[model samples]
Target: MNTAHKYMESTQMPSIVAKSLPKTWMTWAVFFFFCASVFGLAMRYFFIGDFPVLEYKNLLHAHSHIALLGWGYLLVTGILVFTFIQNPIRLNIYRKIFLLTVIANLGMMVTFPVQGYGLFSIAFSTFHLLLSYAFTYHFFKDLKNIKSNTGKTLIMLSLVWMVVSTIGLWAIAPIGSILGRLHPLYYLSVQWFLHFQLNGWFVYALLGLLLSFMEKKGYSVQISTPILIALHLSLFLTFALSVAWSNPSNYLLATNAIGVILQAFAYWIILKSAIKYLNHQTNLSKNWINHLLWIGLISLLAKAAIQAALIIPDVANIAFTIRNYVIGFIHLVMLGAITFGLGALALNQNWLVKNLISKIGWITLAFAFVSSEIILLTQGTLLWAKMGFIPQYHLLIFLASALFPLGLIFLLIAQWQASFQKHQLPKFIHKQKNQFKSKNTETMKSTVLMSLGAAMLLMVSCGGGSSENQGSYTPPSAQKEKVADPKGIGEIKNVDLGDGIDEALAQKGKAILDMKCTACYQYDGKRVVGPGFEGVTNRRRAEWIMNMITNVDVMLDEDPVAQKLFEECLTRMPNQNISLDESRQILEYFRKNDFERTGGSDAAMN
Candidate 1:
């Protein structure tokens, strides 16, 4: 009845179960991710003009670092440690390393945002890097007869790639010292690490784990040697896409393009194989853990498609030029693909509580993640086309995003709340039932701890149902209560005459924009996160501009122009929630800029 990876060796089952319960790392990981989600809320605050004390750039650093090191790093490390290493001494050492990892993350959480990469942050960051090297060593040492199974081999390769990715980071200081930070080499080196870390290491590691899981269950989900080779070849070679924007030589571009295409094909093969092997488990697909895995696979497909698109130099250039596109792509992989896989695996262990509150908690986190993504992509599209905005963007997004952290808090509570009372007697009984252990005190203690997993599985087998099958799946609130176009109080209440420029209003609007909108919008005909505002008054109607500035969320929902922006630009504008007076001033500023561009009479312009 044990739900711990079904294929766990009989000898290792006791230890695995012992380490699985309490799920200390998994619970903490979710908590840290939730903490990171708070930074996501802070981003929305910029649009709502809420929490003015927030420092946008610094918090972004905190968010990214927390999500990457705290969540991604922890999940991967935990899976690797618990899955393969059975030696008590080695397991203890792994826990110590995890402890240090936690400390480093805590240090980074404090230092990175405050100083934006000072001595303390750098030390902690480097601490993580060094620990990674240690992980690589231990992982390699612990992996036994890896070549016997494709899944384990893939994991081994992923660890190697992980170490390889850090080469760039190791070189960064020297590279920056020799050439300025702006030098292509410096940035390229950073990109190298990021590219391989996510695409090469993380992707392979997650997939390998899934493959191993299926195989352990007596399924035939093997990735043939050739396909595995092709996958790795493509993964390592796909680094070209990262540097394609530098207008590399034709030979290099072609090589990179081929690699990208190959990467897609490799994934396609893997998917087909997974489906073939998991065909029997379809009946169990209703499980929430399976749901997470499916979502992860879908996101992975999307990632492959996007990477394939970048094979076209023109497409790559456009993507490179648009910052929003970059952020969207990154998040798609991080949140949608990678985190989803990790979340499912963590939940699969059955070490954490399985109850309604935990179920709702995951749903809340998922809702927040999906909502934020839609808003971000909408904003990016709008910026690309110099068009409309998301309706009530910041406020709605903030509200949705809040649920993510809230869900995590509930999940943490669930972890602690999961009962082990019935689980206690069963540990000794389970051993007698299975006859796997003796009555030694140390052995009994460890087995009892480990049997928590088996005991819960027993409870489950004896009619304690999982939330997965509690009822039919309900749609998210957004879809459940569909709004065709939110028009109430959002209607365009005023329109400018567009007759002449008002210098005072123009100046004030400019000042306000510098303070509030500079993160995305630009004024000098050069795009930052969105299109430049130069000659802005010419392309849009006076009323449209006023509505966009003051009532954009409504406009995006109801207005065709705004929808067009969202579709074409692939980024929508966030609702700034500025006052009517401020919006009117912005309109005056736009009119004056248009006047200057058109060589209108100087009196109003001056």
Candidate 2:
């Protein structure tokens, strides 16, 4: 349990089954982060700044899920399990669940980009959720044995928050169904899940690790017992500020504001503990892992400050409506705060190869992360000011994002080389028993070549590129152009229902829904990419439904309901060009579905 020796060698495989498996798992997880970055770049390239590599919407789904589920989930889980699972025999079950999580993540990575949120992706997502539930249950049962109250309490609080966040995640479909994805709840549900995930589970879990690490080092994070209680309470309560966009009651607002203030103090308490430990250390280097951590701390503070600002009614109202501001803030939290914190933990634990090339690679990634944030926040601010767009913004972001993967490639190569060196060392000593063993020339040569190749590609990718063939921004002017519905097209001003169900017509409509709507909406009250279709008839009028199907763009522009849906969902429904007859058929199908769920004989409305 002596941390310096215990953790310093964590990156090196200690045992046959226990250590090696976790090492391998972490490596793959890190690689997934690298690959997720590619998906992220593709989104920026096509959607924001450059050429169409893939559908913008699909890329967005893929990128976000992969980053959050695949990378972030795996990274944090790996670190937490390896650091705490005191019983190594328990490692087998942990490994099994980890693999399940990976499988689910891979399913999302493949299916999300291809079809966005559909059957395949949702199934995988569900699998991961269930797996997480199992993992959490077992983890809590096991870690409850930890003697220290502070560490165990923080860990327990994190799991509770994680479970709580899923409430918001699962509610999206049902709530969206009830409110047509146009109500404030649809958006607020999503924000609720994310706020808890990032701020609640992730932040607290990392802090728990810090505490665990400190205890192992024979140091304790000193804060008053009363303050500790406040910290835990405030962690859950501060979520109010994040959902200020939902415009809660004044009492809720006051409570949330107090939570935020308490949270600031909570962080200070943790920071005090961290400073005590770091000041005694002498591992500072030009490699600058601490710099990334500083970025994370600053970003966390800034996020808190922004949330505090939203307590002002005018700012809350303005921020609630602006899409760019939301996107910028999310990335700031994800990339700047969580990612940097994880990276610093990895480095501090000696979980990375510390050669010059790897050092450069890590720093390069740091640069890319920082640069992308600069562009994103700058662009978001410009949008808030009604500025048109930045020149070459997408291409610039694309290039900046590419560095992330490129850095990973270097880091991976270095690790591979390190493993090779470790393997070869015995032979090297045997071959030169009478002499000194030195750096392998051939391996160093490969490292040098790899570095050169990485450098050249980074330059080509980032250098000034053509904006014409690639593309430009979404255009500020585009927002002003309202989509007007074609007069009288697919209009359903009246309804004539002679029977309970149009059996054949309903079948055909179901087929159409299967083909076209499968990506987003579902018939049975579960959300896919869009809101579930349960009680659709209750939610919208026949005419409104027809208008939405036939004239999506027009509805998105001029229809307040449709506009609200778009604002909340953050994705526009593409026009599938339904015919007048087809629209009627779909409505009849909806009616039939409602009858089946209610278990009533087919009833016709006047």
Best by TM-score: 1
lDDT of 1 by residue, 1-606 (tens): 475545344435455334542376676676678778777667657656634443455577678878888888887778776667667556756765665676677767665555444445566789988888887887788786344687788788888888888899888878645643334566678778888888878888888887877777787576777887888888867777666544345565677778878889999998777766555566444687677667777788888888798777656654655554676688778877777776776677664556788888877767766777777667756654545456775577678778777988888788766532224445644554243323332553564344444434433553332223222222222223454332223445446354556787888776556444655765556443356677666666555676777776556545555554543232445444467788778777777776676654223222
- Residue 453 lDDT in candidate 2: 56
On a 0 to 100 scale, what is the lDDT of residue 126 in model 1? 90
**Stretches of model 1 off by over 4 angstroms after superposition:** 1-22, 50-54, 145-147, 246-255, 419-606
Model 2 spans with C-alpha error above 4 angstroms: 1-14, 47-53, 176-179, 241-243, 246-255, 283-287, 318-320, 386-388, 418-606
lDDT of candidates 1 onward, in order: 0.66, 0.66
Against the true structure, candidate 2 reaches a TM-score of 0.67
**lDDT (tens digit, per residue) of candidate 2 on 461-509:** 5331222322222212234564533222345666565656879888777
